[model samples]
Target chain A: MSAFTRFTPLIQSLPSTIPFVGPEAIERQRGRAIAARIGANESGFGPAESVVQAMREAATGTWKYADPENHDLKQALATRLGVSAANIAIGEGIDGLLGQIVRLVIEPGMPVVTSFGAYPTFNYHVVGHGGRLVTVPYVGDREDLDGLLAAVKKENAPLVYFANPDNPMGSWWPAERIVEFAKALPETTLFILDEAYCETAPAEALPAIDAFIDMPNVVRTRTFSKAYGLAGSRVGYVVTTPGTAQAFDKIRNHFGMNRIGVAAAVAALADRDYLATVTARIAHSRERIAEIAQSNGLSPLVSATNFVAIDCGRDAVYARAIVDTLMSDHGIFIRMPGVAPLNRCIRVSTGPQAEMDLLEAALPNVLAKLAGGQ
Target chain B: MSAFTRFTPLIQSLPSTIPFVGPEAIERQRGRAIAARIGANESGFGPAESVVQAMREAATGTWKYADPENHDLKQALATRLGVSAANIAIGEGIDGLLGQIVRLVIEPGMPVVTSFGAYPTFNYHVVGHGGRLVTVPYVGDREDLDGLLAAVKKENAPLVYFANPDNPMGSWWPAERIVEFAKALPETTLFILDEAYCETAPAEALPAIDAFIDMPNVVRTRTFSKAYGLAGSRVGYVVTTPGTAQAFDKIRNHFGMNRIGVAAAVAALADRDYLATVTARIAHSRERIAEIAQSNGLSPLVSATNFVAIDCGRDAVYARAIVDTLMSDHGIFIRMPGVAPLNRCIRVSTGPQAEMDLLEAALPNVLAKLAGGQ
Candidate 1:
C-alpha cells in the first residue's frame, strides 16, 4: 500500500483501527442478515412519526447545504435548555465533537483521563491526536468518578471523559454525586460529561442543566440517538458556558451537519409526547431483556441505560461464544465489552418486541450450546 | 467569558471565525425571510423523487447508527464509478473531507498551497490545522496552475489544492492541462483535485479516473450535493489509490455518515435519468442567470458550475453595495469573493425560475439604488 508519503508523524503513527465494528459489517462478513439489530446502543424504537415526516419534507431541500451556523437548531435547543444559543455548539455527532474537543485541548504527549473501558471512540480521538491516555478502572460497573478525578490531579491532565448512564454495563451514579464530581475537578481539567443516555436514565440520575452551566471547564455532550431514536441522523450537541462552547467553532467543520438530520433533530425535540411514549416502550423492553437473561440462567445487571448487560457467570471466552453463536446460529446481533472483567458480560440494546422475541428465543439455545462446549 | 485555561497554545491562539455566514443567520439577524436563496450555490432543483423516497424509507431505521464501515454505500459508489470499493472513502461532505485531508498532511507551520480567492472553507481548514498558507493568485479570472506548481516546488510544500470548474470565478482548465499539472508536481506533494462540479462540467474538462491512479499523491473529491441535488444529504467521497484512500480510516469518524443520507446518495446514483435531467436544468438555469446579468448591463462569466459570477464593472465597494441591497431590499441572497480583483464581481447560484424571477426583478432595482447612492 503506497499511501501519501508526507502525512504528519502523528497521523503516520496512528493505526487504521475503528472503535467498533458496526453490525452491518458483521452481516456482510458473515453473509447473514441480522435478525435482531441491538448492538451499538442505537434505539430500535425509531424516531417520532413527526420527525420522519420532517425528514421527508426536508428531503426536497437536500440540494441546499445546511446552514453553517445551525441557527434554528441552536435557537430551539437554547430555548429548551434555558441558555443562550452561544452556549451550544452542534456537530455531526458526539463522536465528531469528541475529536474536535481532543484537538482543542491536547498537544502531542498530553495526558487524557477516562475510565478503563468507557467509550472507545473518545479514546480513539485522543490517540489520533497523540494524547496519552491514563485510564481508571470501573468500580462496581459504574465509572469511578473519584478515580478519574485522582488521575486528572495526578497527571495534571487537561481533559477527562465520563459518560453518565454508562455504556456496555448500563451503570450510573446519582445526580448529586455527578455534580460533586464536576465541582471537585480542578478548573484546569476540562470535563466532558457525556449524557448520551440521559433520556433513558432516571431523572435523578441527571444533574440539573444549571448545575454546571456556569463552569467553563465542564461540557455535557448530549445526542438524539438514544430515546429520541435518531441515531442514524448523527445529530449531537455540547452544552457549556458560552466561552467554552465557542471553542468548537475554532475547529469544527461548520458546514458538516446534514440538512435532513438537523430537521429530524428539531422535529424530534418538538415531539415530547412521542418521546414519552417511546420512553415507556424502552423501559418495558429493558425489563423484558432482563427477564430473558434471568430465564437463561444469567444475571442481568441493574441498568439505567437503553440496554442490559447480563453477567454470564463464566469467563470472557464463554461470553464471547454466546455472543458469536447468537449471531452466527440465530442471526441475532449483540455485542460485548472488549476488555477483561467487563468482557465476562454480554450487552444487548432494548428494541421493539419482535427483536426482543427473537433474542428471547435465541439466547437459551446459544447458552445451552456454550455450556455443552464447556 | 472565561474558557478552559488548558487549551493547547495553537488552539488558544486561533480565533473562532466562520468562513461564511449562512443565509439563515442573515435572516435571523435582519429579521426577514430569504426570498431567494441563491447565495451558497446550492441546487434549488432539489433531489430526485426516488432519492427522497429512499430517505423516507431509511428514516424508519433512524435509531440505528449508520454502518461504521460504510460497506454498502462504498460498494454502490465504487460500482457507479467503475472502481474497487477500497478506492473510495466516504465523509460528511467535501468540506469535512477537506478538513481531514489537511490534518493528514499538515503539521504546524507547514506550507500548504492553494489559489488565492479559491474555496474559503478549504483555506479555513488549513489554517485551523496551523498550516501556513502559500497562495498563488489567479490569472485572467482563472487559477494559475503554473504558478501553483511553482509555489509547491519553491516551498517544498507537502499539500496543494486545486478545484476544477472552480468556485467564485467559475473557471476551469482543460483535462490535458490539469493532468499535466498533476504529473508535474513533486511526488512528495499530495494534490487535492476538487472536482465538486465534475458532474456538470464539459466532458473534456475532467481527467480519466485512471489518469493519476498510480501516483498515490492525487485524490479527487466528488459530492452528491451538486447535480444529484443532495447537498443537504452531506454525502461526499474521495477517489484515489487504495493506499491513499485507506489513510482516512486512521482518523475519520467511521460511523459519522447519516443512514438516510447514504440511502439518498445510493438512490441518487441509481437514478441516472434524474441526474441527467437536473444537469440540463442547472445548465439552463446558468444560461438564464447569465441572461439576467447581461440584461442588467453586467458581464456574466462563462461557467461550468451551478452558479454564475457577474462582473459589475466596479470595485469591491460597489459589488458589496449591490449584494447588500439585493438582500436588504428584496430578500435576494447572493455572495461575492472574499479577496480583491475577484471581489469586484458577485456570485449567484442557479435556482428554479421563481428564484431567478426574484433575482431578475431585484438586480436592476438594487443596481439603480447603488447608482442613486453614488
Candidate 2:
C-alpha cells in the first residue's frame, strides 16, 4: 500500500476512480458476458466499411509517429466544417479534449460551474487540477441554463460546461435557446459547448456552425465516436476562434494520436451516405427503445440523443436494482445518473436490432425481479 | 484573435508552443516531400507483419471502446514480466504517461529535476503544469546521474526524470549505476526511469524489473513504439509499486486507449521472435548509420538506441546546416537537440539500407555545401 509521498496536494486529495465502470469490468466481476452493449453511449452500428478498410491500410504505417501538428486531419475537418484548419484542435477524444480544456483554464481553487449530475469525467479533471466545483441542478431532466449562468456570475467562474443533446437524460434545448445561453454568458467565461451527440439529435436542436464561430469563449467539442460509429477510433475536435484553438498546442500531447484512428476518422467523415443511414437506424432504435419502455409500464423521456432515459417510477434504489438485475441476470448492461431524481431513470443507448431485441426480452423480467425484491 | 479573458494566470503566462515540428509540417513549409524519414527517432523499418495483421483484425472492432481497465493488455504484460497486473498502468504512449506523472507530483512553481535538454516533451509537460525546472547538464553525452541527484537534493525536487539509452544522444549508464541512482534518490523524490529504448539497449544497460519493484517512488516507463516498431499504435505502460500505479486511475482518461492500438501492442508483445529479429536489424542499421557519418568525416557517437547522433565537429550552426541541407536538397529528414553542446550533433534514426544509402550519398554533398557556406 506504499505510495509516493510527494504527490501534489490536489492529486493526493482526489480519489482513484473512473467516471464509469466499463462493461468489460462488469463482465469480469460478474463472470458473465454482455449480451447487449448499450451502456456507455457508444454506437453499436459500427463505423462505415470504408473506415475499417482505411484503418487496416494505415496499420502498415504503425511504426511511424502520427503527425504532431495533425495537419491533414485538421485540414479535412476544416474543409468539412467550412472553417479554417487553424480554428480546429484535435485530440484523442472529447474526453481527452475536456481534460486539456480543464487544464488550460482551471488553476488551483478556481471556480468551474456545471450541472450537479453532469459528466463525472469533467468533474474528475476539475477536481484533479484543484478547481472548486460550483454545481447547478438540472431543471427537470435537462441542464438548467439559467441556473448555470447564475452560478457562473455569482462565483465569477472562469469555465463552464454545457452538453447539448445531453447524456444520461437524453434531453436537449433547441438551437435558439442554446445560442441565447452561449451569448448570455460573460465573455470572461470559457464555455465548453459539448455536442457529442449532435449527430443523433433532430436537425432543429443544433445551432449553425457560424452561430458561435466568432465567439472566442465558446468551444464546441464534437466527436466521431457517436454517430460516425468509430468510438474506439478516439478522434475528437474543438471548434473555436483561432487563438483559443491554438491554446491547445501549449499542453496537448503533440504526437499522442494513433495514426490508424485518425485515418479511420477521416474516412468516416468522408462517408456522408453511411452517416445518414446510421442516423436513420439510430432514430428507429430510439423509437423502439421508447416503445419497449412504454410497454413495460415505464415512462421514457423524450430524447434528442441516440439513447433514451426510462423513468422506473420510483427511487434510486429501485432504478439501481433494475440496472444491476438486467446485467447480472440477463447480461443487458445499462446505466443511470449518479444523483437523485436523475437516478430514477435508467439510461440505454440505441443499438442494432439484435441488442434491441435483447433489451426487450430483459426489461420485463428485470422489472418483475426488482418488483419482487421490493 | 479573441480568446477567453479569464484563463488561469499560469495558462496566460505560458506560450502556445509545440516541442517538435513534425516532418509533415516541414514538408508543407518547404513544399517538398520527405524522401528518407530518418528523423524523430521513429522506426522506418515498420512493425512486425504479425502485429500489422493483428491491427487489421482489430479494425472491425473499432466500434467498441477499449476496456477502461485495460485488463487483457495488463494481463499480457504481467504474464510476460512475471509481475501482477497491479504493477502496470497503460497509457497512450510514454509521452502521455510522462504528462500524467508530472501532473501527479508537480504543483505550480514546484521544482522538477532532469538532465538539461534530456527530453523536450517532458519539459513541455512540466512547464505546462506550472512546474519550475532545475536542469543538470549532461556529462560526456550521458546523463550525469550524480549531478541530477545533487540538483534533486539542492532543490528538494519531488520529481526527477532519467532516460536510459537516452534520446538524441543515444548514450546510457550501466545497469548497476542506474539501479544505484534510483536507490540513491530521496524517498520523497519520484524517479521517472524512462526505458523507452530498453529493447534497443544492451542487457547491461537495464536493471532487472525486481530491482526497483518495491520502491514506491520509482516508476519505470516502457513503450512498444521503439523496438516493437509500433510508434503509431501509441501504447506505453509504467511499472511501479501497486499504490503508485493506481494513482493513474484517478486522473487518466480511462477510455482513451484505441482498440486496435491495444491489440497491436498485445500482439507485438506475444511475438518476441519478431522483436529479436527487429532488434538485430536495428543494430545493423545503427552500425550502417555510424559508418555513413564516419565516411562523411562526422564523429558518430556510440549508440545504444535505434538512432545515431553524429558530432558535426563545429557548432550548432554547422549541425543545423547539415540537417537543413539534407532535407531541403535531398528530402532526407533528420533532427538535432535544441540546447547548446548537444546541438553540435545531428541525430539520424536507423532505417532500411535504402534510407541509409540516401544518407550515405547525401551527407558528403551537404557537408561540402556547409563547408562552402562557411
Clashing residue pairs found in predicted model 2: none
Instruction: Write model 2 residue lDDT over B1-374, tens digit each, in one string.
Output: 87777777888888888889999899999999999999988898889899999999999888989999999999999999988899999999999999999999988889999988899999999999889999999999989999999999999999999899898799999999999998899999999999999999999999998999999999999999988889998999999999999999989999999999999999998998999998999999999998888887889999999999999899998889889999999999999988889999999999988999999999889988877877
Q: After superposition, how far is residue B19 of candidate 2 from its true place, in Å?
A: 0.6
Query: For candidate 1, lDDT tens digit of each residue in A76-120?
Result: 999988988998999988999999999999998999999988899
Look at candidate 2 and tell me the lDDT of residue A342. 95
Q: Candidate 2, overall lDDT? A: 0.92
In model 2, the runs with Cα more than 4 Å from the true position are: none
Docking class of 1: high
- Candidate lDDT scores, in order, read 0.91, 0.92
DockQ of all candidates, in order?
0.86, 0.88
